[model samples]
Target: MVKNHSSLLQNKEFQYFIIATTILDLGKKLSWVALSWFVYQITGSALSVGIVISASTISPLIASIIAGGILDSYNRKNIIVIENIIRGLILSLIPILFWIDALDLWSIVVVVSINGMLSSFTNIGSRTILPSLVNKNQLESANAIVSMTSQFGYLIGPSIGGFSVALFGEPMTLFFNVLCFFIAAFLYSLIPTESYQSQNHQKTNVLSTDNRMRKFFFDTKEGMTFLLKFKPVLFIAFITFFFNLTYSPFETMLPIYVKDILLTGPESLGFMWTAFAIGAFLGSLLWVKIKRTFIYSYALGLIIILWGITPTFFVYFSNIYMIYTLMFIGGIVYAPYNIISPTIQQILIPNDKRGRVLGVIGLIGGLGFPIGVYFSGMLAEFLGASTIILGSGVLTILLGICVIIHPSLRFSQMTNLDNIKENL
Candidate 1:
């Protein structure tokens, strides 16, 4: 196992891919913070901020369906590089528009929507390309490494973003974001094209435009059908959706909880998130060292149970330090599910169908976040954020228990691709 991991690290193309993804994640996080602050600064209305944020969030969900077909039909490496380049070019307009005093709220929303839509392709491409980069035995380690470095962006991006805005202003901060994306694109381009040659040689093509559209829909339907027929993947996807639904409230309501419940300031909220990011980063590292192969379904259930339990403590604890500690521990438990779930999918899904299947899974799982946030916000207005959060935690715990006891998931374990295909 250690030898495989060491050899995986030695693969220079994989190294470039990881660095590119980390930089891409950092740019996105930084831009999100900068854009949110800028929107609020200009409008002084939380509603405007919500509109802009929702534009970015909702656009990606809409694009994932098309993104899946594009991923399968195109070279994923080229798609990733092109997407990043387009994103950088689009984001450059923000700073330029602001400089010329031509930037409007609507224009910002439009740019963010376009970038968000493009990002779906890059995000899915990153995952689908992973199986080509590393051997199956090294997937867990590769995933953990990817997750760990990517979490580094989450850990520092917002802090740097806020500081950059204060010191350099929104336009400059946005320019910084553009720079990050361009550099990430360059890094991705550094990876030799030959690395993905085997994966891309099987692309499907149609000469007729009408037939291409028809083929696209047909491929999309086929992907969904495969996901439904594969019971274990289907079950995991459902669990992921439920998990997002129950956990999103914790993220969406954290600021209010810090302010009203803990009677703290923005600094305290920052500290809490930082603590969680630190824990998540360490957890990813620890996961890389762990030797045992998990029964993916059972392990996910247990992880979710622990994850749900950690946040429930928020209902009881009023101490800010205690909350930070719990957030840190919660982060640790959350890391494993992210690593295990995708690794299992990559192992089981054939390379030909992998992109579309992952895309459908992405759409199914992604729906929970925006829907949960929307409803949770509405419910919080009536029941209070604390009550809503408590309910989310409890519901999550119940869902985890359901997974553990469910006839399909309970008996499912990690298996080789051949066995999974045979069973299917």
Candidate 2:
């Protein structure tokens, strides 16, 4: 059990992972702003940007199974090293293509799709390796630290990116992001396999059979079966599907909202995202104390309710300051959900099954993103972005209310309390 969160860095590999994650996240945000604006410029339609973003999201629906199986079968360190290196290589092509005037909307979509596919491996591997890296009591703190750095990136990266875009142009700004990915890959490469190797926890590999296609199906089935067996995870998955579906469109429409409704430039957009991260950063800081000392069930529910209601207020305001305020509050509500979720999963599942089970969860959650974005784009083309945002807020609230009514989900909120009591 980790008595001090500060002591977490004493483990050298965890230290490397944290540093790598922070560097990558910071660069990723810078690159993301460039990419989104670039998409908007190419097709001159909000719908086109959504289509391009959705192209990446679509692969998680299919590649997740393959990713999970590979993580379980292969060395995870190699997965981290290889995945980021490839993504860095793939993403580097964009700036090169654009420089030669060879970049097109379809080409952008293809690269993003491939990068998203690779992300499943890196993401699942990261989660799967955490339990091996820290004690049970340290999971929340570890995840909280990670969440804080990621939020910090979102907070600061955009402001820098916006100015960079104004100065260096989007393609040049993206090259910095490619470097960030490479930096992360190098950090992962530095992690000694002897020091932080994952213990093979499962006695039998799910894909022991020789029939390749059949192995895929059976492995997927095994993951699904494990997910169903755990009621809390299954329930969370069910509730999140609705919120994520609505949220996907909400996110897809945000850049357009900044331009048309908020009446702002990329600078204001940067501040709005910065506002969110500040709120989320505050929330996560509180979470560290709350998880250590108090009843967290109520905190979880309050966060969910706030998530649903915030957007309703969001659409009524046109002033950028007011929108920034709303974004900050939304970020405050958002942090706990992201930080605590994996901590709960880590505490619940055994070490071996983490990859496969999380893959299934990703598959389930990821399904809503592309489908929602595509349709939302079509509707935004007709009804306008404000209308879509309002409708999404209402639906998100409805899902929150449903989770409140569901007994199992309500019990699931007591999870932190139960863990604390067990420790006592």
Highest TM-score against the true fold, candidate:
2
Displacement of residue 381 (Cα, Å) in model 1 is 3.7
lDDT string for model 1 (170-287, tens) is 7887888888888888888888765544342354543466766777788878888888878777777888888888887776666567667898654565567667778889888787
lDDT over C-alpha atoms for residue 355 of model 2: 75
The best candidate in terms of lDDT: 1
For residue 190, model 2's alpha carbon misses the true position, in angstroms, by 2.4
* Tens-digit lDDT track of model 2 for 194-239: 4334344132333355654565556667877888877767666665
Candidate 2: what lDDT? 0.76
Worst 10 residues of 1 by lDDT: 197-206
How do all models score by TM-score? 0.89, 0.90
